[model samples]
Target: MPMTEEQLKGILRRFDTNGDGKISRRELRVGLRNLGLRFAGFRARRSLRHADANGDGVISEEEMNELAKYVSKWGISII
Candidate 1:
């Protein structure tokens, strides 16, 4: 099943070390790693590439849902 925005956000909160209300590449790296995913760094870069619309090098709150969708498309659950 695809991951939901809520689920994704929950994961973000769990891993948002800097508490900056955004998902930086580093944060996503840690998050995906906690998910037991291999190639987490690569996945983070890919997700940022897919979701960072403004090219700001981070996934803002506004881009979270998009990020969730991209991750779901990768068959990775938010949990």
Candidate 2:
């Protein structure tokens, strides 16, 4: 089944270490690792840094929305 919005939100919540209602680069790395999607630490951090829009060290809801839009248009959900 495709991942639901609730599931995604839950995942984000679990990883938002700073409790800022947003996931930072560090959070994403830990979250992905928790999900068994391990990558070289530097590589993962770099990838997330590139994806982060505001450069605030974390990803905001706007970023996630954009990602969801992109995936809906051209990518397949792993779940």
Candidate 3:
């Protein structure tokens, strides 16, 4: 199943270490690692770019939803 808004928020909260309410590229790398994704450097950048719809170098709530959809489509287990 696709990730719910609460699930997304929970995941974001895990990596929003600064409590900024958003995930930056650095935070995304750490988050992915926490998810067992282990993305790095360009790979991490690409992943964030894909989710960052606004190209602001961060993942907002809406962009996080889009990421959840992509993850669901790819059968990625975020838990």
The model with the greatest lDDT is: 1
Worst 10 residues of 1 by lDDT: 70-79
Model 2 per-residue lDDT tens digits across residues 1-79: 5776556555655777888878766776676677666473554476456556777776677677543433333233535
Q: What RMSD does each model have against the real structure?
A: 2.5, 3.9, 3.3
Tens-place lDDT digits, model 1, residues 2-79: 555697667766666887887899999999998898999999999899999999998888887788788776666654
lDDT of 2: 0.60
Off by over 4 Å in 1: 1-3, 77-79
TM-score of 2: 0.61
Sorted on lDDT, best first, the list reads 1, 3, 2
Q: How many residue pairs clash in each candidate?
A: 0, 1, 0
Give the poorly placed runs of model 2, Cα more than 4 Å off.
40-43, 67-79
Error of 3 at 39 (Å): 3.1
**Per-residue C-alpha lDDT of model 3 across residues 1-79, encoded as one tens digit per residue:** 5556568657665787888878888987777677776444554577677878888888876687766655444455455
TM-score of each: 0.83, 0.61, 0.68
Arranged by TM-score, best first? 1, 3, 2
